[model samples]
Target: MELLKLHLIALFLLPTSTLGFNKCNFPAIFNFGDSNSDTGGLSAAFGQAPPPNGATFFHSPSGRYCDGRLLIDFIAESVGLPYLDAFLDSMGTNFRHGCNFATAGSTIRRQNTTIWQSGYSPISLDVQYLQFSDFITRSQNFREKGVFQNLFPEEDYFSRALYTFDIGQNDLTAGYKLNMSTEEVKAYVPDVLGQLSHVIKLIYGQGGRTVWVHNTGPVGCLPYVMDRFLVTAAQIDKHGCSSPYNDVSQYFNLKLRELVLQLREELPAAAITYVDVYAVKYSLISQAKKLGFENPFVACCGHGGKYNYNRFIKCGSKTVVNGTETVLAVSCKDPSTRISWDGTHFTEAANRWIFDQVVGGAFSDPPVSLKFACNKMNTSQK
Candidate 1:
């Protein structure tokens, strides 16, 4: 309880950016990934979807899966930029440097099926990178013509852009839910990583040198997975992350870190940083009582008792009528206070806290050591 108070105090004081740290080296950020890092690009595409999650904050679903902002938003702000608008948003095109290509429920592959069959655009990461290449080409041509109408000139804009990739949760979760054995799942992991590597290479080819690659988090701890897989509630731990799932996540992260090092050696010009978001996140949840959080596994959304979820239904949908199998969840009274708003994503407030830690360099080894390679370009121009 004493610790929970400290955590709460941190929350209250967190927004002021008073934690005293070096400012972000990158001038702008370009984000790509699934719901974790997405800024509502997917939600907007699903137009006419009744007041989505962002309804509470924006008075409508502003494309973000959360009530407001995700990790990318805070990261942008930390560096003195507005939250990056999704690439598809009209206002998003106005942002100078960054654009979010991440769509909710997206993956690196075409065929991997997950819990939410509402699979994002048929385009995989490979196609997404191709799209990115096209955008870069367009931006360059626009700049050469002196049409500074876009956010910034091509040189300064793309050079300073920080590329962030946080995805793969859905792919892993999908495999597990299908009852695949550990070895079978492990076999598929390499393919996923290979796709990630290909994307990284594509970005490097596009003159993006500052890459922040995020590995999978503790997928086992998610409420839906825990409730479905764990035999006893006691197995859910203090923070609600399932132990077995976390174990697999750790294994993945370990391998991912090694992979990042290999990628760095391959693309020496880029500033590559490996992020262990899971470790930092786990720390906060480990002492949840001190952080003023109860039932980390229990989603703020969902209906019904216990899990408040069904494999067949989604949140906010009228799945049940007349006490039948409805959406099976209810959003919390104040989503801002809850760590998690749904079975798979964190609330906006929670996301901010996580960003604060990462920006403060909590998740990286040897701290935030990546320098802006673009700085050299800037000096050369002078």
Candidate 2:
């Protein structure tokens, strides 16, 4: 009788929702994009990201480009799932939750014709889909063989999981690198969004019913671009960002939102929501003082410049300046108080703040809270 009483007490003390039984209804989360959402994907692929990159949180390089966790990490944690492991790092990976297919320098375009940058990305959106297919096949085979039966999800896991996309920034950056005019870059939006829509439709066809897509953030505020273009005070916006770049970002976002509406109509069974990451990001810059950020424009990890950002001496590099060897990407004394990380990405603190705003439902279309979106039923045609 005493033991029974103890067991009852223990049950009451336990959290309502346990691991693998999330209240949000999402059994897993699969992500695809570039550096913004990449955890260790780039490092696993090219072995490029190194030290001080993950200093603020992991205290060691975790292959994330920022000082800490990205927005995707926060989202995974919010939904009661483990951090999504990079697909390239297949060893010891726990795919029962989800997988990350983002690469640091990846672009949506398959060919280099649209991308001005050199080299080829083996894991483009199309390639990431292929990887997902392979994973599905392997898991099915394992299940059929009755191996780790309880370790994997049911046969319809993809339809129940959340599919997220945070791409397109790299393509725009490439266009700028090639010295394309604003009009020329704007013209490229249709092609980029078309590819993105194609991927979304493909996922839907493959049983993905809930998709959350983040629009491109304000690239104008990145110290990398501001340092290069905002030579005069007049060129900077009130928020200390490059107006030209922000304008381009705004244009892209407008078109992306429109596309989301179209997708919603076409895929009535799918919960296709657009997340306004740009507004959340820009808010941090515009309200830096209120947000407790001492330096909103300067990069937390960079070298030798007004904003401490040098394209040649990017973060995690070393260079000799004036006969003295200096670490190119030295971190600031307090990364938590800063906004930008390496001129392009946010500090972990900033990312956390952004996540808080995004999950609140105000920044999402159809006004569905992130938690609700995850838990909602899929209306996609069977």
Candidate 3:
């Protein structure tokens, strides 16, 4: 009877070319981003501050800019993977599956001037890919295995594993806030796109075939900007999302789509998919009323009001004396009720729902459908 059971198990495990089996075979994820995808990694590198950064949930700062998980966390969950540890974290080096390289306040460009207050200097998308190259080399050496050994023992991991890049908001924000000339901004954009293209080439050069590249989002509408500019309540749309920001976001998204399409043509072997976070996030905000999100624009943490985040006052500061005015803010009753955990980041709930659209369904655009992107690589594996 035991022999029969073993035979049955072997029969069930026999390799088949079904899409479900192919989809389930993808091994791991490699991620890059700013605070949007950071998961307590920066804190591991920079240490944490009290009262402000993590006052809501972790009771102390946890590297992540938000009270809890970020978008990367949700994306990993959607794909049946563990919460990826920051590649920089001490415990992360041994993990074979996923490694996140996002840092809080990071932009697509290294020296983003927009939010200097956050003490954030992005790893730039170029640097991010360069680091990926280094990571591959080191991973091969440390494990004493070929680069693709753990990634794809069956020669299919490269095709099966997920690759995600979430960046660009910082680039647009820096360009606009720094008052860079239009020609300068326009010229700089191609360089940035060129850098992105180069990064895609590097990944493809290293055998990365399936990737999900996220475009920029509505930065102008962020509470930080709204409060800084003192935008009128009426200027904000019904969803409390600012229109100008959304418009700019749309433009950036359009350009990004064009760039990725070009990369696809250039790197024919890669199956790159574009995730339109702008539309996904916008649709989420539009449905906030029905989803029971009380304050789509209001931040769950930090000082509240028009700004939600006081760029001047700074969160977790002791500037306010006992007799002084209330400067420090509190988190909301239920963080789930809000779409934003801070003035600039998304709530866990919002992240999960958006992940559902991009990773869990057909909302992903270009290159090839995500389903094709993930499975195509495996099918081509030799």
Clashes of each: 15, 2, 1
Q: What RMSD does each model have against the real structure?
A: 6.4, 8.9, 8.9
Please provide, for model 3 over 104-172, each residue's C-alpha lDDT reduced to its tens digit, 9 standing for 90 to 100.
766666673333454565465666677777877676665565453553123335455788888777666
User: Per-residue CA lDDT of candidate 1, range 179-239, in tens?
Assistant: 8865667778778888888889888886787777777777776766766665465655555
Candidate 3: residue 307 lDDT (0-100): 46
Put the candidates in TM-score order, highest first: 2, 1, 3
Looking at model 3, which ten-residue stretch has the lowest summed lDDT? 373-382
Question: Which lDDT values do the candidates have, in the order given?
Answer: 0.66, 0.80, 0.65
TM-score of each: 0.82, 0.87, 0.80
Better of 2 and 3 by TM-score: 2
Candidate 2 residue-wise lDDT, 1-382, digit = tens: 3323533543443333323223457888989998899988878877758678999888998889999899999999888888988888855677777788888777777656522344335577888888887877787789899997665556788888999999888777778777887789899989988988898998898899889999999888888877765446776787788788888889989999989888988887887878888978888788887879877888889887888898778788977889997776789999999998988888999999989877755566654557767543323211
TM-score of 1: 0.82
Model 1 Cα displacement at 186 (Å)?
A: 1.6
Write out the backbone clash pairs for model 3. Answer: 40-64
